[model samples]
Target: MKKIPVYLFLFLLLAGCSLSNVQHNEELEDAIYLIVSDENNDKLSLNSMTTFDWDKAYLFTPYSTQESITEQLGVDFKDPSDIDWRDDIYLLVFLDSDQVIQYAELERQGADFSIGEKQYLTPTDDIINIKHD
Candidate 1:
């Protein structure tokens, strides 16, 4: 009947909505943070995952934080943000702690980064290690 078809369409549309209904903590199962090592090999803890600066990719540091750059690495593991650290530096992407690397590639923009998001991940492996790359 027409009533049945109309109800089905409405249900499908509502299900497809992309708006977030959960809090930030619920969105991220594990806290995300970045570990940065400066040119002098001084490691810094950038408590946020800031976006990559496509514009200043090579000019200077990508991340500018209100917190001092001298702040030591490693947070309490109960924080989340949208900032990351970059410059003439090396970056390590950690999920919860230094032991677990979310991005296992040695280099941040390594070749493994080219793999499709879904294809590069396995449900059974919480952490992935790329050896051949």
Candidate 2:
């Protein structure tokens, strides 16, 4: 009976450690964000199921090669470091509940703008119209 109790305790301890590791991995995974833009450089879109109010738009970081910011955005982005257009200016589009969108520019820092790992969070709706220049 004592041996049986000892085995049970060991099994529980191992299970707890495994669960903790899994949770840590999940936290790391959630820390990245992917910023996707079109060829026109109009707006950046994210495949996220979570909806945000118009007021929350400013809180989002523009898609860029910055690994730290991208990580905090909870996106999995591709490494955008090697691309030639690293100096190019990029815009971020914010959409409102009424479908109205706004734009903001992202400045380049040398070859700093690289896309990181990409993971799809949710399905995004198609664009209707983009008015910015």
Candidate 3:
């Protein structure tokens, strides 16, 4: 009976330790604003969009620009002047204090987007709802 209680306590202790690993991505802890914009320059705030999958989104390295990110992803994105903003979308995540614009390219409409490392994907319904004016 004494051994049974000891083993049970050990199991609970180990379980708690494992649960510590399941946490929000530390990189996003200071995020204060998240917005999505279209080619038309229309903006929508996603700070209220609770269901967004932060796991599928990753921040680009600091000082990243459109040209640098395009080269990194091997994607031939259009020049800023050439792009028809009305047809496409971009997601921007801004951190606190400094207010840096974390660049995000919508790789495909209603599909997945890949940056240099992580894949950005949101539920199709969420995209549809947010894309509306």
Candidate 4:
């Protein structure tokens, strides 16, 4: 009877550990972002881009332009048609203030590149723009 109780306790402890590991892996896979540049090869400014959410990922620069914010800190910019979904690179950006978190993935389809689904640390509405040089 004593051994039976011990075995049950061990089984429960192992199950809890496994569950934690799975959750940690999931978070790692979702924490990624990409950096986008402008025509002049300069990073876009974050002033023009919308604030980021800490819990969700964002597509920083969807298009290349000369007038848009050329530099951003938390946003991940990419060309939607140039990404390879199966072989996409993963990236993660930590906001300076610790308020916003960015994640990104690239997916390539035929002649087009697409960004994969992103997971942010927070909602989009909760992000505030931070200036950078």
- Measured by TM-score, the strongest candidate is 3
* lDDT at position 62, candidate 3: 29
For residues 20-73, write the lDDT of model 3, one tens digit per residue.
432333233222223222433233333444333332222233234667545534
> How good is model 4 by TM-score?
0.22
> What value of lDDT does candidate 1 attain over all alpha carbons?
0.27
Which window of ten consecutive residues has the lowest lDDT sum in model 2?
22-31
After best superposition, candidate 4 residue 83: deviation in angstroms?
A: 24
> lDDT for each of the candidates?
0.27, 0.33, 0.36, 0.33
Tell me, what's the RMSD of every candidate?
A: 16.2, 13.2, 14.5, 13.8
Q: For residues 58-109, what per-residue lDDT tens digits would candidate 2 score against the true structure? A: 2222334445534544433233332223434433333354232333344332
Clashes of each: 6, 19, 2, 37
94: Cα error in model 4, Å: 20
lDDT of 1 by residue, 52-126 (tens): 211110001224242421132232221123124443222233333222222211233321212124222222222
- Native-to-model Cα distance after best TM-score fit, residue 126 in candidate 4, in Å: 28
Best candidate according to lDDT: 3
Runs of candidate 4 exceeding 4 Å displacement: 1-4, 23-133
Superposition error at 92 for model 1 (Å): 16
Ranking by lDDT: 3, 2, 4, 1
What is the TM-score of candidate 2? 0.22
- Models 1 onward score TM values of 0.19, 0.22, 0.23, 0.22
Off by over 4 Å in 2: 1-52, 55-87, 111-133
